[model samples]
Target: MAKTLLRSVGLFGAGMIAATLAPAIGAVDVGTYKELDQFMSVFERVRADYVDKVDDRTLIKGAIDGMLASLDPHSAYLDARDRQNMRTQTQGSYGGLGLSVTMEDGAVKIMTSQEDTPAAKAGLKTGDYITHLDGKLLYGGSLDEAVDQMRGKPGTRISLTVVRPGRDKPFDVSLTREVIQLKPVKWEVKNEVGIININTFVNSNTGDSVRAAIAGVQKSLGHDPLGYVIDLRSNPGGLLDQAIDVADIFLDRGEIVSQRGREKGDIERRYATATPTDLAHGLPIIVLVDAGSASAAEIVAGALQDQKRALVMGERSFGKGSVQTVLELSDDTALKLTTARYYTPSGRSVQEGGIKPDIIVPQLSDADYKARPRLREADLRRHLINEAKVDDKILEDDGKPDPRFQLTADGLKKQGIDDFQLDYAIKTIARMSQPPLRTALAGAKRGAK
Candidate 1:
């Protein structure tokens, strides 16, 4: 049965909801109604007294965004463009210049550009601000509007006016749009172990892709892979269902993840069931993640760690543990509402505290890893607070380097080594694959002489 959910406010919904939910539906109320009236009055004044005329659509959308922003970082209004982009991401292919961006300080800031995509090829770095798209100014406009302008048919060109930090002046770069197709799971045999790099959980067939990758790796190596390294570094997550499905691909049976919604009986749990071919066949698995691993990425990592199905390595995940349900509105618009908190099988929420790796391996080969501060849920404005007490280190900006990882990126580069975290994981897997000191020692070593 369909249930009533929290309503968004354009007409002072907080007070309106309070009225309907109060013990006396029609009870005597003064402060509540008066406050709502005051809000509407101000809203009207803004429409009337603003320096320039603003359309009702812009005003209403702004109000909606403000309302959602006040709640949490994930809750958002998806305009027609935003809705289509969300669909494109989850469905895997689209005609566009692939990249993720967000509104920051009145400009559109680039997040990590997807690998092999035009954005990455165009040398767009994280935090680079796009002031204009196709020569049209994006400042003083909605982020959704900017995103709409970036997507188009293959072979179409979009010129981006970029304002990169450390550069004296802004510059423009033209990129041809292409059909952005993500090979979500890419695998290779390294050190006799299969290393599967899951770029994203955006694609619907990510689980199948993983299975195929593993099987192909084993076939190419002419022997069973020593184990598997599931690389999730810098992977901004996508669909929740895909995360669950990917987690289940390796497990024989266990609860992958669960979500606790706002109301009772809203709890949903997903379990890892037997697949048609458990091709991996009880091999040791190591999952690698970093601060960029979030949402769906955390789900897979957390579930595997909790179930003891895989050893989670590398830094803690990005800690985006909230679930956003897209509620469709009129005219292709939607609402990305944060409705629940995701929990691992052990009932641990990956909120402000992300999934801590069983073996923490910092990326010592990436020169920029230390220079750039990692952002987590704790850093987000109006993020959902975790009820459990957390250590200051989780939220602290201790710029000091770790003694455990003393390898210099320059030295590693000279030695022809890159991706120190993956290198460490591969070495660890090699050690584990070595035959035990003895099948039983065969027998204890006798004292010499």
Candidate 2:
């Protein structure tokens, strides 16, 4: 029945009523009008006989919230305040301490402070849990409410009390809100290898930043980098168009990604159309990912891997292949609904199952594990289920280990295999300057074409 309703809604263009339902019905078999009449009758009775007066607006808002909440977790009803915040987030400017936060075990925890922002300058750590704001209790409150309390006009002051893991008591930090413009790319040249840290995929100048990073490497090394290491650790992705643009920077020509909806003939494919500006064409490219790397991050990882353009290192990505379409409501609120599921060039789904790294390298330490910082996993409270019934040997190959690449981890030392992954990539790049690996990759490319 729900599937039928969804199909009907899909046909009518989500949340819009059917043309046949626009007219008042004398009788209906499904009791749709009768249920609404019953609800209205109860509402009228409550207005007439309730112990106190109730605002109609409050009731209507509650109904809307309840309705949206009944959908999937990603589908949400955003009020005007939330809509404004969404705009602020997408525009990459917000008046606040400039910290990403998540709710964990009923407490608001700092995810990561934006670089050069008030939170970073004031010494807020990633693992700190916010216990109070402006001396008001914050735990057990909605994340939205906590965000509202933290945000204000530029130059306004706000105080936060945080519980650091190793600290004894909660510490108070006061900061003045300022407009935060996030820079997505940070880079450095190390041992003739270009290492670029992509914090997010949202900045308007990400492509320019990447190009500049490559140029910086070229200037430092007196030539283009022998190899490139892209660090995407702890990067929750943003902006699909930016992801497409970033992928285009590396590929000469190929399909980057594609989206397929339930409707027939709704498939859309995005392809690379430009040549790379960097001179590191055949250089050994290694991408670093972790559990925090998600969405657009997965798209880039999957696309590059499908084309065999780069070797992926670290853990599997956070699977979030669904695409959301934001719809404006009549009351100035909004709805961010998951309307489509995207697929990689190889036709892989990243919804519940994320992209498997070409080389698996555990990046977390015992200290990181014990810290118990709030992450998307904790926020979503995800539980892994057995999917063997679907494909018993999805990662297996011919009863033998697949040799597409080697997977290694540094273990819990935090300085071992995981740290060594990037070093190894750099070494591989250095060897690529004179190696059989470079010859093999070149041969593979020739074979592919």
Candidate 3:
């Protein structure tokens, strides 16, 4: 069954993945031969007459990258460096500045640095833009290229010029590379509620870690506890199966998510009733997502919300519902292909317009909430389109203020309210646990400015 998985994957319009010699096999016809000849003609001309000397490998890699990139933003050619990086990811360790980054406006923008990592220790914040590496100007290279430069042997020091938001000047921060062992699940019992923060889905055993955390919280509390709050804010996604496992941990039954390929009627569904998957033990749960939440993170959030297993809160999530399947090539390289799109159990596709929470909660304590321009799958160049009817503009904020969110960031800061979203979730959980809190919250809501 494991061996036939690849063959079965082809049925979902990933037929090209299994075709190893498709170019040669399909070039039997005269027209196909002519097309192949045309490709070679351009390739030879660039190699022979280009002003700068170009190697066969460089030209071939460029051609491969272009071909895959043309398909979608998520698809790309992974060179040897990229393949090695993928291997490092599976090992759950990398010697680097320990920052998750993306290319935005010709700069390498930091997306939430992992805690206790070099990036976080060095005072890196989300939304800081790295304009240069070690004094050399960096004007937009691929995200992989920028990350490769930041990674080196342990103890190696590198400097980055960071342009922070609301700052007048860009500053340089020196950081030493270190081997980062990511702990995907961390839980703490706050006010008798389990606050589980799944930072990333990098590890295959993330679900197990979460289960252990939940158990530990229950053990420490010496009680069933009120509920759990799964915080998925600023969590850019990782492994797909980990997401599935995490979602299943909360869902007792029903379909979790489905992936449909380019071919019509070609889809695969993942269900949660397979093996007693509900690990929360039928407890009340709330999921918190922000504009930075995406991909695998969105998967778990959407599943729980669709199954009515958890209440989703916060702003619309960053829609990145496409699946990237890495196909290895003969040359120690690979192709990160976007084979299919993500769909909720309700058959709803939040491709560009991400999952809307049951209750929209804003980050009142974060002053930059109004100005923070977060990236979405829709913002990506050449992102895969959702065939389902979707209004991309629906994800945009109307610039209208909600009366319930009348509290100012400055006022919250004065009151030492660091995180309004978390505070709201805890209050909501407390209300759920004690009915009297609901009356208090209701009166406060009515009196809210």
Candidate 4:
């Protein structure tokens, strides 16, 4: 089946090609004679006429980059260093400065500091522009280059110059690189509610971590949690199957997600097959999402919300409904292509326009521009563009306050709800624990069963 799909995509590419060779066998024939002649001509010209010596590796990397850039945004040729970093990210462990940095306006800006990491420990806040790395000026360098320079052996020190928001002078700080193991799921029993903060949906361990968190909360509560606060803030999604597994843990039996490709009859649906292990049946649950919550994370939030299983709070999610398939090239390098798109159980495509929260919350304040702990619109610019529409019927117009529930620079000043959206979720869960609402939730669960 996989081979057939690949062949179909290859055929489609060939059919669309105007100047390329004809489609033959499984792969498209790229006019062998012409390619050979062109290659020799370029090689001869370089060897005969070049004034300066060019490194072979540099030339090859440029060629690879150019080739992959023509396909799509997600498809790229990763060198050895890039391949190693990709492995580190997926495994959720690395020796680094513990900050997610990106190239913004020609400077490396701190997107979000990982919790309890050296960057966070050293008071590195989001939106801080990194000007220097290890006392060397990082002006006009790519984010990948800066990040690679930051990662090194454990206990090695690196210096950074950062310009913070509302500050004119660049601040210099030195941090030590350590073996940082990113714990995807973080749960705590707060006011008798299970507050599970899922940073990302990666690895097989995420489902296990969530179960453990629930068990711990249940043990402390002397019963299963009466309510749950799922924090998916800043969670740029990871593995798809893992996201489905996480949703299955909450739902008894229902469709978690459905994916559809361009070809007809390619529709596929994944359903929940087991009863929930954490909260008892009909337990009040609220899922918190923001612009940073995306992809597989959006899948979970959208599924639960569509089924009326969880009250989704906070701002609109970062919609990333496309699916990427990693294709191994003849060389050791891989091609990650956006093959198909995924939809919520209700058939809403969260592509361009992400999932709208049941409760619309804007960011805390206009002037207090602290980067929310989730992926924002700016972060997703590098991803491929595949637009999908959302059904208006499934969306709720809960005319309350905007769910923008982060700690605004001003809100941080006063004693207001720092994370007002999460606070609202907690309060909503508490309210739902009342007899009447509990009965409604019970009915919903019974219908799901």
Give lDDT tens digits, candidate 2, residues 1-41. Answer: 00000000122221133235556544445556556666666
TM agreement with the true structure for every prediction: 0.81, 0.75, 0.86, 0.80
Predictions ranked by lDDT, top down? 3, 1, 4, 2
Per-residue C-alpha lDDT of model 1 across residues 1-449, encoded as one tens digit per residue: 11111123344454665666577566737787776667677778888999998776777778778989999988888787676766677675877887888777778977667877899788776667899888888898977688778978999999999886666789999999988887788888888989999989877788889888987998999889878999987788878888887888877677988889988789989888866534677567789988778889999999878776678998887888888887777657778788888889989888988888888887777665655556677877789988675674754443566686887899899877777888888888777666683221212212110
| TM-score of predicted structure 3 | 0.86
Question: Residue by residue across 92-145, what tens digits does model 3's lDDT show?
Answer: 687897798878777888877886789988878777899999998888577777
Tens digits of per-residue lDDT for model 4 on 300-398?
999998878888888777777877776665444555666788888888878766888876655453343443244444244465454543443344344
lDDT against the true structure, per candidate, is 0.78, 0.69, 0.79, 0.72
What clash pairs does model 2 have? 410-417, 410-418
**In candidate 2, residue 72 scores what lDDT?**
49
Q: Please give me the total number of clashing residue pairs in predicted model 3.
A: 0
Return the lDDT, model 2, position 117.
86
Best by TM-score: 3
Give the poorly placed runs of model 1, Cα more than 4 Å off.
1-32, 121-141, 145-178, 263-266, 274-278, 394-404, 437-449
Ranking by TM-score: 3, 1, 4, 2
lDDT of 2 at 68: 64
Model 2 scores a C-alpha lDDT of 0.69
